[model samples]
Target: MTQKTMSSLQRVLTSLSHKEPDRVPFFLLTTMHGAKELGISIEQYFSQARNVVEGQLRMREKYRHDCYYSFFYAPIEVEAWGGEVLFYDDGPPNSGAPIIRNAENIKHLTPPKIEETPCLLKVLEATRLLKNEVGDDAPIIGVAMSPYSLPVMQMGFDNYIELMLDQPDLFAQLMKVNEAFCIAWSNAQLEAGATAICYFDPVSSTTITPREMYLKTGFNVARQTLAQIKGPTATHMASGRCLPIVEDLANTGTAIIGVSVLEDLAELKSACRGKLTVLGNLNGIEMRRWTLEQAESKVKDAIARAGSGGGFILSDNHGEIPWQVSDEILMAISEAVHKWGKYPLTWLEDHG
Candidate 1:
């Protein structure tokens, strides 16, 4: 619909993959507050498909940041598996009950066929709208659940973990089914014109045994789903330090790994080497609590430490910052990265 010389998404994607750019990229992970701050209501935006697309377009124009997520969430994956959700006024939707409570319930589980599921179809439409409207100005990143997380949707967290310990075979079978669902779902987004798919598999990193990560999930289903996609794929590890499994994860060969606070961003960069890109670890709460200058400084520091070799893209260490994060503070963080972040150790002298 509109055109610009250089947009945020293109810059970040190029730099993070180790290519040179006009400058280091400034990428903000969007949250409810970011939308509201831009004059859109979070409730109204996420509820409707057009609203979601407009909201993202508005964000890119306002912040001029490098990338934006597709405004889709992991709960949608559970919904595809026949799970129900209860929405709230304040935060994300929560799954009401596991679709597959018992092994026998597996028979009833069917992945939502794209046309048949209104919620999912809405996302596909939103993605198409974004890809067409934004074009190359910004890269639209899609999301899919890790095979490990699908079980938590089918069977609650406690049940899924116990099954991993007790009935390993059933767990693997469930993962395979979910993996197929992911391949289909992610491909739908890619075909819809997404530049990349952001895969969330916090459960595997947080709860499962490393044995499960390696022998069962890592080398098998997760790799299989990643292999199915032609475009870039990113895996977001939600919980604490997933460092131990980072190498095995790198072996899966996704293009980016989204890191949380538990992860040492520097170590993650070192481990992935040239094989993968590291996305975040900004500590959202800290960003809110500290002064804008302090927050900006932290962002600069993270970029310098993690982005040194060039595969690091900046984002908060955790989920979206709360709705109260001030526009000035947000702007400060965004501006700091673009101003201070550069190649060949931009902040090295300041740090030393």
Candidate 2:
């Protein structure tokens, strides 16, 4: 029997449920690259809600990838807490400095009010606009920094590790404040029209810290925060290795988790087989220099490794495409995925 054609929504949903649809669902995850497409500076592209929505629409037109990413730079969230955010000529903005100066600061820390934060409000408005425009067309993914991982921005990496190890109580206090902020911010996006929220937690990866550390702090925070989120969510570890902690991540109530390029894709798929969906392993950092052939080969290999069943969503590993990646390579990747990503993937044996 022949299968019926599926919409992008059906494709992603079927894959999320571990069922093969007509084709494998994939998204480009072109975050700041959208700004690059608009021929505008990152600062200008993110200045207004319409600019982001327009960039997304144009990005889809050019790449034709599934899923609309309704996200702004991550550090913008830190701005809500009074952290200075510095934009750039290339890539996303970075926190100017750690917001927390000392351990006592954690005790006095409070969640930033989302409504009162302008940058956050613009992001929420962008989500609402995208939903109004293509709400039924494809998945709209909203992003939130995980409470456990946000500490890296709250304090410097070294300071956060010290606090996590030497002073558990202070870390807990920080998590409490961040947790409230995360839930409220995430729900606001969902209400604005996000299909699911992406919990970005790079510091939770074992590559960033010991597996034991993740188990103790990141795991519990993820579990608790995920419970409070009103909608389905995905746990993403940026580009860091997640396999050592993938099993623990499975129990965190997330529908999916973004894998990293540093790990083996086949094993990651096998590990996530029935538990949750796998989102990627594409090496975005090096994509700027990839030729058409390299782009095609990598996409083909990734699909062949993880696209057998429906529990896969292909995307760049690090979540955001660097602003430097050119149009030709990205277009080539999309073409390759569409060529080999069809259900059954029987073409692999003859050609690949």
- Using lDDT as the measure, the top candidate is 2
Q: Which segments of candidate 1 are over 4 A away from where they belong? A: 1-10, 34-41, 206-208, 211-213, 344-347
Q: Write the per-residue lDDT of candidate 1 for residues 252-303, one digit (tens) a residue.
A: 8777777887667777778877777777878776666678779777887787
lDDT of 2 by residue, 159-241 (tens): 98899889989988988999999999999999999999999999888889788878888889899999999999998989888
Q: How many steric overlaps are in each model, in order?
A: 7, 0
lDDT of 1: 0.71
| Model 2, residue pairs in steric clash | none
Question: What TM-scores do the predictions have?
Answer: 0.90, 0.97
| Whole-model lDDT per candidate | 0.71, 0.89
After superposition of all CA atoms, the RMSD between model 1 and the true structure is: 3.6
